[model samples]
Target chain A: MIAPVRVGQAVRLAEWAPGAPIELSEIPANSAKEFILPASETIGRYDRDGARFTMRETTPEGPRTVLLGVRPCEAAGLAIVDAVFNWDSRDEFYDARRAATTVVATACAQADADCFCTSVGGAPGATRGADVMLRLADGGRQFIVESLSARGEELLRSAHGVTEGEAAADPLADVPVRFSHERVTGWLAGQFDSPRWQEFSLACLGCAACAYLCPTCHCFDIQDESTRTAGVRYRNWDACGLGLFTQHTSGHNPRADQMARWRQRVMHKFSYYPEKFGMLACTGCGRCARMCPAGMAISDTCRAIDAEESSPG
Target chain B: MSIAEARDEAPGVRTFRLTFTDEPARARFFGQYRVGMFGLYGLPGEGESTFCVASPPTRTEYIECTFRRAGRVTTALQDRGVGESITFRGPYGNSFPVDAWRGRNVLFVAGGIALPPVRSVIWNILDRRPEFGDVTIVYGARAVADLVYKHELADWQQRGDVRLVTTVDPGGETADWKGQVGFVPAVLEQAAPSAGNCVAVVCGPPVMIKFTLPVLSKLGFAAGDIYTTLENRMKCGLGKCGRCNVGSAYVCKDGPVFTLEQLHRLPSGDM
Candidate 1:
């Protein structure tokens, strides 16, 4: 499983079939220009000029991939997706993408005002979702690529550019993450009765931006689209925050109010997910906190619920 | 939860039971397998129109569940035949604690198809007949011809330990309509069951449960003392899917059969 870096060229992923560096942006563009990539490699499809552009793999199915130089939060987002994707009825499409992609994450040394990964349960260098995490170690020179998953180890073994070395045994011990998952989960579990959901829900724009931006939010809906003769049933991600997400065919909506919808978000991650899967759905990556214009911090809300629960009655 | 097992029940209904199917291992968890949070003996696909175990949970000769052709999951279940498969996750909802009711009078009120869940309670009660006080069953339906498990009810009526009261609406469709008429609530009110030391179990459509609770109340039944089953859209049964929420409580996890006090505390009105 171990290989040495070759001379005079950057590491080549088995994905490229030949040696060359394909930046993250180039892959999507390459898929649009050439239809040579594997069908499953097409993570998503874009329709333009009656043509489709797909970012995909070299084969229909393959081992893990080296998605080099991905942002740490983006890497963290992948962990969030695991909750809903693997939930009761597994989504093959999402599962396939997750299986194919091997993230070598680079931590964010500089976090913005919106960054609250630590607040929720992640840090600027959060590795909750990363298979192999690449930190700006040695002052941003040789990346401190630590393997967080067995898949991470396999990808690092295949990495052609770097020298393999023993990982720092305590990667996050000294790293200032500023969040406690135990506290977050403890708070989330008892938060089912909290009133903060009402106020937080009011602040929500209900545009489904939080679900779309977050790496972990994986709400999807299945639709049977068809022509006169043929129909294909495809499932696309859906968000509970959407006004019409839970609307029945007869116009009956269970989460008619923002409060109920907001409650579902917290419950899905903390309560419903844990009760079913025995783990929290959220990695506390805080992507929703960073991207939302409403200035809502999911961490703060969860912590508030936890604090309320622990306070003397 | 994919279908691990399937079979056809009486008439048009189908009973699909799932244990666990660990893919990498290429084996299934059946009967007594307790995978994760579920007991691993119930069918999950038949969405949460909750039904009690017609057969025993521990008696897993065939993880028994008998569902009629009703709403969504039942409709799908009805179409399924023996050996046909469907997705499911659990026997996740709450069950009647039969052991606790030992030596206590158990009153089962079944209104129409509601007997399926009540049957489990009744069967368990009768199975250990020596453990309980007198058993009284008051069952009614829209018409005499539509009563489920008719022959069984008639047999139970003849038995010495069980007192079976059968009734139908005013318009009697069957020739054997000697029993009382009017609704189950009206009949229960007329019978005047004493409130002391007895558990009254009721299950039916939403309207029936709503009206029957008052009758139990009139008989001096406390909210905590009264027990009934609930029905809702339960896709996962494992409480993962959001459909079965009655507040923070997922009915599939908290209950199909719950005390009245528990129902009153549910945050979401979906109950």
Candidate 2:
């Protein structure tokens, strides 16, 4: 039932655009990585930049880029990046691309080993940051397209080649309800001086891959890029996990030890972020635990913040 | 309710006029807030720097600050043009207890760009003249070229009750210099105010304060009678950012200003 689509050119929305919901179903890709990629891979290597995705693929020049049949996690990932982009300096490169694109998210049916959304405070089929969302039914015949944002509504209005309809809410809660947030945060706050950090961060490779793969991690470093004739100063995504990440020219490294760096990672997500924005920075995407070659699992970290085994020195 | 504006004052020194960028900021500290006293400074690709509300609280709309181009963030600011879009986060840090210094004789001691944040207190005293005693300024620069608040200096000189002394180090161009030529600590010793009745506020290069303190004490100024402001590279303006701290004391939280009595007990390592 799914097919390739160009909105506004072919058919109309399955329903009223803004007021009604629109579901974007499986539209096959032109190739392996044609579109619907992270701006890091698509636009800017370190962050969102014009014509600079991670893969060096340029955003199509003329018409708006439509990433149809996208999932909610991806959309949520985009929203997480927005905070970092606007933090110290507004990255117009990231903002403009986000403005030009529409996010239509679908519920994820499968969860992988690297998935820890439940632990980090995300649900399997979450609708937190998506502009538009759709839930695929058990029978796989119809979809429940939910409009989550203004852009989602606009996309729904102009969407084409679909039947307009609403699907019943899932009878069971979509979120995996295993983790206790209060328990985890309380445990973390009290374990600041614990030795567990030393043992736990021992295996950290300092490769920064974890930060790179994360859906919410957004620290960056700016450097000047130039080849003999022309140079453009650019900022790229940076990871605190790396040893040299915060090193100063004076040769003093503030977060030099892996243990201290690990502490900052958790603190930023649970303690610091909430103190400022009244929200947690971690989305529990579980990508870091999954991608870490060292087997760093944020799940295991929950109970250990108490430093259960380590005696206070 | 408050807004941030960039007002250039000198080379590599920007007087960022910041107030509240959001409504909540105004609701908490209104009337005394300026649209410009609350500002967050960050490099385009780096991070933000926390600052004090340099504009006098009485202005209620502009918090001005002047920073030197010592690090990456300030260096980036040098390249930016006025009215260019810049992101700021706060009017962070504990402002000088201007409301408390009301009835006391206030002496604003500034060296080089250090005068920027301390300038807030100076202007406030001028604005609300009824609140405090006579004003005395002991300010210095490495060279005559380095002094900020030049044009403002002229106005300050005209005030009968306010005493002003401008100095440059001995190495400075002394030909045209009619003012004192020596270090701040040395000049403070010579221009010894009646220490018992006056509150001495000093802000300047780190080395300068290190030397100035004992001199103030020799002149009979009690440790509690003198105050100095502090600065360190900071980000997130909010204490949550964690970059601007010295020990458990986040400069953003505990202070950029400390009374000499407090400074004596504080671990020198923190600054």
Top candidate (lDDT):
2
Give the whole-model CA lDDT for all candidates, comma-separated. 0.58, 0.60
Task: Estimate, for each residue in A1-313, the C-alpha lDDT of model 2 and write its tens digit.
Answer: 1113435543222223343333333221121011222323222222323222111323422225554454455556666656645654455555665667665656766555555566655665778767777677645666677787788888888878556655564432244534555565665556666677787678877887766666566655445443333333444556667766655433556676787777767766666555544556666656677667888866567546534434365
> In model 2, which regions exceed 4 Å deviation?
A1-63, A67-71, A80-93, A138-142, A164-178, A225-231, A243-256, A306-313, B1-101, B105-131, B134-271
TM-score of each: 0.61, 0.55
Chain A TM-score relative to the true structure, per candidate? 0.67, 0.72
Q: Put down candidate 2 lDDT per residue, B1-271, tens digits, no spaces.
A: 1225655566666665545545666555654453124356654344445455666766655345676666666666655554443445555555566666667887777788778777877887889888888789988988877888788887888889789988899898457777899988888788877675688888877688889888888888888878876665444344433454443445555666668787665435335
Interface RMSD of each: 9.9, 8.6
- Considering summed lDDT, which 10 consecutive residues are worst modelled in model 1 chain A? A26-35
Candidate 1 lDDT over B1-271, as tens digits, reads: 3344555434554555533334432234233232111322212222223444565543344444556665554574555544444333344656677778787887888787667677767776777789899888988888876677766887898899998888888885467577888888898889877777888888776667778888899889888877877655444455444555665566666776678888776644344
